[model samples]
Structure formats: structure tokens, C-alpha cells
Target chain A: MKYHLILRVVTRLLVGPILLYGLYVQFHGDFGPGGGFQAGVIFAVAFILYGIVFGLRDLRNRFPDRVIHQLFALGVLIYAGTGFVSVFLGANFLDYNVLAEKGYEGQHLGIIAVELGVGIAVFAVMLAIYYAFAARPPRIDDKDW
Target chain B: MELAITLFLFCAIVATAIAITTIRSLFAVVMLSGVISLLSALLFVLMDAVDVAFTEAAVGAGISTVLMLGTIALTSRTQKDIKRNNLIPLAVIILTGLVLIDGTLDMPSFGAPDSPAQTHVGAAYIARTADEIHIPNIVTAVLASYRGYDTLGEVTVVFTAGLGVVLLLGGMGARSRKRRQEEEG
Candidate 1:
């Protein structure tokens, strides 16, 4: 089925702004109503809209399977690595105070790093789910008997 | 102002729940379920449980709905008629609902500042968080630092779930390959 040009254009315009807004939420989460999880979902929604419009095959082509898998692992590593750094710094896991040893600015930096990790993990997992379902072959029984 | 928004959110939650349960089509049910989750997240916000709401809105409304729809696409959408009655499950649900209502009768009122949850650890966390952690978003500070172990376990659970999916799908493929080889031989 052919998608309407107007609908596609509108989706593109809205998605771009929504994704940017998600990033803003991620960065400004320290003083706002949103955090990593909300930002991640907002980001995922943008790509999901793209998949809905352009079809799953095109989405897969745009973001290959290997890249998504690596991103999934990388996000976890980033989160875990932050915690590991704390351990090396003679502090407990995820100890933000051990980050800069300066002041509140260091804490803000740590929170941003962790939030970004969470956002990336969520975004990759969401896309992975979409790719899995969208790429599945139609059941033989679904065909005309 | 928040109270007005809370009332509207409650109504939205109830409406979404009704819409989800009453829908006949499986796909429609899945989509409506997502809406129900989103509404619940809004309700959580009104309750000042922003962190819980964030997780709910993301995992419940987003990923869970997509997974359910994907499974439905693999299976038949039509609900099969059960020859036997579903009296037992229905009775259990009704009884559970009754128990919940009974329990709530003795519980604290909504947004009671002096409630137990908001008194001890909650108050301590709120008070000392800024001095100890220096993080503006108290939720992240609590989850990642104060309760770091719990967060680690949560991440492990997610990783295990992903591994389980890979194993199950791999097994299915291996079985199919073995069968094909036997047929060829």
C-alpha cells in the first residue's frame, strides 16, 4: 500500500522535532519533568514512525542488524563502565562523587552519562523488537488456501 | 492545578482500561493496552511518582505493546471458544479485587504528606540527597547510587531475557534444520 505524501511529510516533520525534544529532555533532566527512560521512548517513537511509513524492510536496510546488536551491547558497557570507574576510584559502584571530586558539576556530568547510557540501551532494544517482528516471514497458513 | 490534572488523568485511565478490555480485535486490544499504560503513567505523575511513571510509560506502553503485537502477528488473532467454563479464573479475579478494596479501606488517603512512605526513608532521601549526591534529579540518584545493587539486578534480568529469546529462536531453527537434513537423507 502506498503511503500518502502529505502524511509522510507530516510524520517526518513531527518526528524530527520530537527526537530533538527527547535529547533536550535527556540533557535537561536535572531540572525538568523527564529523564532517561522518557527520553528513550521519545527517541524510539521517532524511528517507529519512520518504520510505519517506509516499511520494516527499509528500516532494516537503514539500520542493519549488526549495528543494532553492537549498539545494544555498547549501551550496557557504557553504563557498566561508569560503575567500574567508581570501583577503581575506591568508591562503591556508580559513585558519582568519585567522578570529578570537584562539586555539583561532577554529579551532573555523571547523571548525564548514565542517562545517555540508559537512553541508548532503550532505543536499541526498542528498534531490535521492531526489526524482529517486521522481518518475520508470513505464515504459510496466511496465504490463500 | 495538579489536583485538576489528577482528576482528568484518573478519568483517562478508567476510559483506556474499559476500551482495552472491551475491544474485540486483538490488534486493537494491544493498541488500547498501550494507551492504558500511558494513562497510568500520567496518573503516576499526578501521584508524584515520576520515576515509576517514566519506567511504566517506556516499558509498558512502548516495548510491551510492540512485543505483544509481534506475538499476535505470529499467532491467530481470533479467540477460540473454550469448551469448558472459565469460572475459576473469574472467581479468583473477583476475589482479588475485593481483597484489594478491603485493604485500601485502612490505607492512608491520597497525597497524605504524613503517610509512612513519605515519612522515614523517603524524607531522609529527599533531605540528604542534595548534600550527599549533589544530583538534582533525586530519582536517578536513588536508583543508580543508593540502590545500585538493585539496578544491577534489573539490568541482569534484561540481559537474561534477551539471551532467552536468542536460545529459543536458535533451538527452533536447529530443529528445523535437523528435520530438513533427515528428509533429504
Candidate 2:
């Protein structure tokens, strides 16, 4: 489908900022409203926007399915790894206190790590689902809608 | 003023939800659902649930809309008129709603100081988060540090869901090959 010139241009301009904002939300989540889930969705939005404007082919080339599949599992591993590490440090499972000498610092580190895991997993899943749906041929024409 | 805003947002949400159900065009339905999500996000903000609001806006309005659009692209644009009876489903829904309403009637009023929710660990979490977690946001402290196990479980759930979708969608190669053969055959 041929997209409008304005959409194409605007999407190009917007994708970078959207991605930056997603990262900002992910990192600043501790002090602010957003956390991993929200940031991940926002991050997925940038790619989704790119796919919509420039075509899914362009998006798939830049972000191949293989990498997405790996990231999907890797994210969960990161979260679980943090817990296992805490356990190895003579603490209970997912006990962030053992992460650092100072309890609060450990909590801070654990939160960042866990939130990253959540963000990455959510981001990949959203894109993966989008790819799955868009990969199929449309039964109806765009004009019909 | 808060009450007025809450009422207005609720009205918008109800109208959008009704419109979504009544609309035959899948595209319009998707748009209306997004509107409902955005309105709900606004309501969440009014109730001082900013994190929930952020999530609703991003997931509900943003990603879900895009996913629904992709679904419409793959499937039919307009819903089919089915002759199947929905009476049983309607009755089931009404019964569930009535049960839920009855349950709520027994609960404490909103923000009651002595309520079970407010009394049990809530005060301790709020009081200790500053000293223990040193985080200004108590929600973050609880979610990340205190309740890390729960968050890990949530991530695992998301991971499991992603795995299911990948398998259901036929990974990559098999799906495309099947599609090509279908197009050619």
C-alpha cells in the first residue's frame, strides 16, 4: 500500500524521539510513573509506526525475526538470573538486599535489572505478535475498510 | 472538579465501549477501543494511579490498537452477521455482573482508613519505603524490591505468552512457505 507523503515524512521524524522517550521512561521509572511494561509498549510503538509507514519489509530487514526470538527468552532469563544470583549470595530467592552491601543500593540495582528484563521481553513480544499478524495476507482490501 | 472530570471520563469510556460493540466495521471498532483506553487512562490519572495510567495509555491505546489494525488487515474488515444465539452468553454475563455487584456491596467504602487493604502492610510499606528502599515512589519500592518474586513471575508469564504466540504463528519459515504455496496453488 502506498502511504501518504506526509505520513512517511512525519514517521521518519518521530521514530527516533519515540525510541528515546521509551528509554527515558524505562530508566526513569523508579522516580516516575512509567515502568518496564509501559516503556516496552512505547518502544514497540516506534517500530510499529515504522512498519506502518515504510512497510513491514523494511522493519523485518532492520529487526530480523531470529533476534526477536532470542530476546524473548533472554529477557526472562535476565530476570530469573538476578534472583538466582541473590540466592547464591546467601539470601532468599529474589532478595535484592544481598545484591549490594548497602541494602538500598542492592534494591536499586535489582529493580533496574528486573525492569530491563521486563521491558525487553514485552518489547520483543509486541513486535513478534505484530509480525505474525502482518505476515499473513489481508483477506480484504484497504479501500473496503 | 475531580468528580466532574471523573464523571466525564467515565461517560466517554461507556460511550466508546458501546460504540465499539455496535459498530460493524472492524476498523471503527478498533478505533473506538483505543478511545476507551485513552479515556480510562485519563480516569486512572484522576485517581492518582499514574503508573497504571501510563500502562493503559501505552498498552491499551497504543499497542493494542496497532495489533487490532494488523488483525483487521489480515482478517475481514467488517464483522460477519451470524445467526447464532447469544442469549446464554448474555444471561451468564448478567449473572456474573450481579454477583460482582453483590460482592462489592459488602466491601468497605473507597479509601476507608480502617479498611483491611489500608491496614494490612499498606501503612508499613509506606512508612518503611523511605528508610528501607530510599525510593520516593512506594509503588516502585514494593514492585521492584519487596515483591520481586511477583514481578519475576509476571515476566515469566509474558515470556510464556510470547513463546505460545511464536508457536501458534508458525515461527517464521513454515508460515511464509505455506502462504506462498497457498498463493500459488
Candidate 3:
């Protein structure tokens, strides 16, 4: 319907900007009011909006179920990998100081990296869930030969 | 100013709780619960617990609402009427409220700089964190470094919940395909 098209266009315009702002919040959270979790929700909201307007089927086709599953696993892996890397470097687990040959800068870098991982994982899992719930299975018609 | 904010928060909490308990529609109750969580987060911020507020706002208000709605979609929207009186639940809630008020009688005054929470290891952490971790936000330093183990546990809990959802609601495609084959045979 005409209303649906309007919603789609509006959502398309909104999603991109919201997603960008989410990334900005994720990175700048060290000095801001937001952080990894807030960024994750904002990122997820973009896709939720897309699913609402364009239909969950189209959104799923764009992201796909398998890719989302992988992203979920990959996010956790990135977080755990950062901790493991710290252990390997002779510091305790999640010891960001061991991340680089230098000192405090390494810790900062490590935190940012881990935050990014959490954001990505949370965003993907949330979107996958929303899509899974909203999507309806196709129906077959008896007249379809 | 702070006292007024605290009063506002207390009023909001009571209002939300009443709304949640009395609302007949499940969706309205869920949304009101979210409002309660958000107000509690603001109260946390007023208490100078920014990190806790952040987590609460994100998890309690945002994700919990979404998850609850998903569960609602999978279940009944309205509760079945019961023949019995709901007096027992009402009595239990009243008893709980009385016990909590009694407990608060022995608690530290709000915003007291020398409260036990502020005097304990928390003070040391705040005082030494700048030199020790060099991070401006002591909350971040505490979360990502000093008590990183707890953060790890929190992450694991989230991951487990994600797994639980997948187990409960996922893999539908495979099951549906199998059902189709059985019907054909």
C-alpha cells in the first residue's frame, strides 16, 4: 500500500544514520554517556526498524540466517580471543596491558576492540531473534499445479 | 535538588508497580515494566552508579522488553480468569513491602559521602584508580580491569541466554522439513 512505501522509505533513511551513530557511540564510549551495550541496542534497532517496514522476509534475505549465526559466534570469539591473547602475552586473562609491546595504550586499544566485539555480537543476535519471531513460513496453494 | 529527584523517582517506581500489577493487558504491563526499569536506571545515576545504570537501562528496559514481547508472541496474551481470590498474592506483596521498609530503617542515609559503601574498598578504588589504571572513568576501570572476572561472568550469562533462546525457538527449518517428508511418505 502507499502507507507501506512511505514507511519503507522513512525507515531506510533512518536506519543508516542510526547505525552510524551507534558505531560512533561504541567507539567514543570511553568519554561519553553510552557504551558497548547501548551501542549494541542502537545497532539492533536499525535492523528491527528495517524488519518492521520492509518485512522480516526481505530483511532476512539481506542478512540471511546463516550469516547472523556466524556473526553471533564470531563476536564471542573475538571477545574471548582478546582475553586469550592477553594470557599468551604473560599477563592475566583480559589483561589489556599485555595487548601491545607498549603500556597503557595497549590497554585502551584492547578495551575498544573488546567493546566492538560485544557490540557486533549483541547486534547480530538481537536482529536474528527479531527476524526469527517476525517471519512467517510461506503457504502453498492447491491450485498452483 | 537531589531530594526532589529522589522523591520523583520513588513516586515513579510506585506508580509503575501499581500500573504493572493492575493492567489487564499483557502488552501494557510489559511496557510499564520497562518504564519502571528506566526510572530505576535514572535513580541509579542519581546515586552515582553510572555503570550499573547503563547496564540496567540496556538490559532491563531495552532487551528485556523485546524478549518479553517475543515470548508473548509464542504464548497467550491474556490470563485465564480464576475462581479463587487473589488475596494470597496481595498479602505476600504487603508482607514483602513491610519487611523491606524495616530493613531500610538500618540503612545508611542517601548520598552520604561517608557511607559504608563509599568508605570501603570503593573509596580506595576511586582514590587510587587514576594513578593505578590511568582511566578517567573509575567505573570502566573497575569493570574492565579490577573486577574483570565479574564482567566475564556477565558475558557468559548473556551467551548462555542466547543459546537457550536458540535451543528453544531455533532450528525450526530442519524440523519443518522433516515434518513435510513424513507427511509425504
Candidate 4:
């Protein structure tokens, strides 16, 4: 990793754009061909790329495993929370009609909320897997490959 | 042009798969598998399933390949020679392939408007998306608003899987790693 100056520079340059694109996929999912799942994986890729180049120690310092664990649970909470909120609003479970004054608006709000939950959950899980892999010392070194 | 592209993509995918099987280097195999995923993603896009294509590209080509490479790093770089008979496995694969091919014959052709999928609740969902969800993408409306419960379950599954992995492989912090290195020294 220390020897690959060009790789390090390129990764640094690419990480920002990759993260921005992940956000675009996350929020633009309703109108476009992406959603929470794709966005979350893309986000994880961006961070993983940075982590691979910069080192796991650096990445873990910036984003701890504990926080990702919380975010992972939070996403499920958000999705289920949306459903329960609907139930409390005198509607059926997972019903979006009662979320807002207008039915369409409520649906829109509900979709956004749920998608956000999906995104957070997917991203955290993906990152956590990466952590599990990187936590162990690699048997093979970069030069060997 | 579409048909030509599709043919090319399919050929590329088949070629990559063959290469992957023949390759002795585990790294090359991983890279080839990634190539297959990318080619299939292109095919998905050609079939007008951009969402599916996106997921395939990200998860199949991106994440899985990286994770596989990580596995290779954890284990060994080269595939060890095991003198085992491949006849039974090959026969089983062929039989399964034939059954799957036969099954596909009964299904509606791709993009058939009169197909059950299009004729069934698909129409209802489409009609309702514009009226109730006001969203341009019927997929999002169906996934998040219409079939929200299913998606909740999917997210919960993702969460559970993450929890399980972490529980099994916990203590991935810098402090633990540093302590391990110190112990090694």
C-alpha cells in the first residue's frame, strides 16, 4: 500500500465522486433506476476503496465498528418504525395514506422514509462485512499478487 | 443493434465463465467472475432492467469480487490440485440445466404485455402509483409504499445477517488490532 503512490492518489481523487454518486442513487431512487440497496452497496464500495488504499486502521478510526453496528440496527428500526407509525395513525400496518394530509403525499413521504432505512441498513451491513474480512491479517501480501 | 449487443454480451459472459473454470490462478478466477457479473449487468440493462443491472453490477461485480479477493488474501492465492472425479458433478449439473431449460419453456416470453405479470396486479400497481404515490417509478412505489412490509423484512434480514457476522467476528477495532500486533511483537 505504501509503495503504490499512483494508486493512493487515484483512490483519493475517486473516493469523493464515488460517495457523491452513492448519495445520488440513494435519493434519486424514486425517479430513477436505483434504490436503497444499490446506493448502500455503492456507498460501501466508496469507503472500501478508501479503506483499502488508506489502510483499515485509518478507516476504522474515522468510522468505528460500534457506530456501524448501531446504524445497522437503526435502519431496520426506521423501516419498522414507519410501519408502526402508520398503524398508530389509525391506518393499516405499512399503509402510507395516513402519513400526510394527502394520500399521494403520504405515500411519497413513507417511501422516502423506508428507502432511507433500507439504505442505512444495507450500507452498514456491507461495511461491517468488509471489517470482518480486514480484521484478520491477510496471509498473502500485495507484492505476491 | 440491440439483438447484436445482447448476443455479444452473452457470448462474452460464456467465454468468461469458461476462462474462469480453466484458470489455475485464484486471482484470475475472481477477476473473471467479476467480468461475468459486469457482462450480465449489461445484459440486464439491455433487457431494460436498469435497477436489476445496477444491483448486479454493485453487489455481484463489486462487493463479491472484493470479498473473494479478501478471502484469497486470508487463505491461499493458488488453487490446490485435488484429484477428484468430476463425472458425477458434471452429470448432475447437466440434468439440472435441462430441467431448468424445460421449465423456462412454460413461462411467458420476455416483455410480453399479455403475460400474467403485466395482466395481474401489475396494472393495479401502475394505476395506483400515479393516483396514490404520484411517483414516476412504479418500482419504488411498489417496493416502498405498496409492498412495504416485504421490504421491511428484507431490511431486517440484512440487519440480522450483519449482526450475525459481527457477533461471530467481533473486536475489529483499532485498539484490538494494535494489541494483537503488540502481542505478536
TM-score, chain B, each candidate: 0.81, 0.87, 0.85, 0.87
Error of 1 at B131 (Å): 2.6
**lDDT tens string, model 4, B42-109?**
99999988899999999999999999999899999888888889999999999999999999999998
TM-score of each: 0.82, 0.92, 0.86, 0.93
DockQ-superior candidate, 2 or 3:
2
Fraction of true contacts reproduced, model 3?
0.18
What TM value does the first chain of each candidate achieve?
0.88, 0.97, 0.87, 0.97
Q: Which segments of model 2 are wrong by more than 4 Å?
A: A1-3, B84-92, B173-175, B178-185
Worst 10 residues of 2 chain A by lDDT: A136-145
lDDT over C-alpha atoms for residue B168 of model 2: 79
lDDT of 3 by residue, B1-185 (tens): 98898899989899889877666777788888998999999998997777678768877887678767766666656566657778998899899999999999999887788888878999988897767666677766676667766766666666666666665655333455477779999
Interface RMSD of each: 3.4, 1.2, 3.8, 1.2
Score chain A of model 3 by TM-score against the reference chain A: 0.87
- Report the error of model 3 at residue A12, Å: 1.3
lDDT of each: 0.73, 0.86, 0.74, 0.89
Model 1 stretches astray by more than 4 angstroms: A1-3, A139-145, B1-23, B50-63, B166-185
Top TM-score: which candidate number? 4
lDDT for each residue of candidate 3 in A63-111, tens digit (9 for 90 to 100): 7777877887787788888889889989888888877766677768777
